[model samples]
Target: MSIFRNLSSRAKEDELMDDFSMGGAELSEALVHLRRLNKIFAAPGPTRYGVEKLWRMMGSPASLSVLDVGAGSGDVNRKLLEWADSRGVELHIILVDLTEEACQEAAALFKDEPRIQVQRADVRDLPDASADIVTGSQFVHHFDGDELVDIVSHMLRASRYGVVINDIHRHQVSYTAVWLTTRLISRNRYIRHDGPLSVAKGFTARDWKELKRRLNHETMTFSWKPLFRYAVVIPHPLKPGGKESGIGYA
Candidate 1:
């Protein structure tokens, strides 16, 4: 288990452990713990920053449609909706995930929010240009290098404007920090295991560069954010008429 604290672990292969499949009451509890950790760490900050950056670079639209891959419990989408409302921005979100349980959880979470829709489908199967902006939060680390590139391409193809992938940055400090923090605050076994393992499985700067190179798109920009996260924003390659950028590929 201590090996999870080492950044070198990512060199072997992507971690195959997935807590979302645990299902039933245990999965719900784990998801709840995960959401709280996401909030405490400000996981939604990068996605919001990406959208704001888009508005700064491209003109703002009156309304925006967002496709969020691996939406989990849709906690991030809920936060984004509140943020959009405060700014008087009309935002609609389609939360796509492969798990029926996750889709059901998200659907229930956003049932009162008319602007959000929950779908159970693989992101790659979604039609092209399905939304104005495509986004995923803490989701990309689940895939291997090639799979990630392919997923990004699909995301870009489905977007009218851009894509933003917010994930962790693999580093010793982050691995240790997340491990200690989760151990102290969370009793959920899944969180205790997945937290540090996620940091180990996260991407490095070189990994992000390779992913960008594979996409062969010049518009993509990568940055490191606070709380040991990575922000990969790819603005629309073409001129925009519109706007906006989930959880697991697992």
Candidate 2:
């Protein structure tokens, strides 16, 4: 085995890459650029744990509008809706993605549902869009320095309740997992390169802290999961443990 197999997860998968990032194909498995995207929509170890934890922690999801800025292949959106259905939480979703290709793909997943709408749009800057909950999974790791700051700022400004950003944790272990997982699980070239590259470029908890400082520490909560190799919840301030306090981290 390689030394990467022995490194911390944070270091391994943070820089993984997929086909989209590598320009290997026009389309492929959602997991190609789907590093963090999977857990948002589906359920598994850390990803499921994070979403479920936030659901119980928040206590009320009867009225929540969710915005997935970089809605890739509708993975996150589907998972959010599926969560609502299973938990009895009623949610409205606004799905925005950078490419229409993603829109076409996402549309298939949510085509029958009127509550979910996929739009070809950019989420780099969160507009005047107000949502009770703002969530992005595995998506934000695509940024570097100033771009990351700008994206987070835009997200913070738009959320009235809170935000949940499920993203890769920057580290060596994370890089390795991304590489191995892609190699073992996917055959798409785009997913392979972009997957590991994404891991290499991931962010750590410290980065989010810096974002909080720059954004006035507006009542947020942060959790980093080791297994999933990503940040689970970074929430906005509200009455702690209050059922209807309108505070949530998804």
TM-score of each: 0.87, 0.73
Leading candidate by TM-score: 1
CA lDDT scores, all candidates in order: 0.77, 0.60
Per-residue accuracy of model 2 over 1-250 as CA lDDT, tens digit each: 2424332323333333322353224453543346343543232334344445555656765655777777676564555566778778777777777765677767876788888877776665556646765667666777656766677767756766556677766677666766787677666665666666666556777767776676666565566665545544555554557553454344
User: Candidate 1 regions off by >4 Å?
Assistant: 9-22, 238-250
Mind sharing the TM-score for model 2?
0.73
| Poorest lDDT segment (10 consecutive residues) of candidate 2 | 9-18
Model 2: how far is 34 from its true place, Å? 4.0
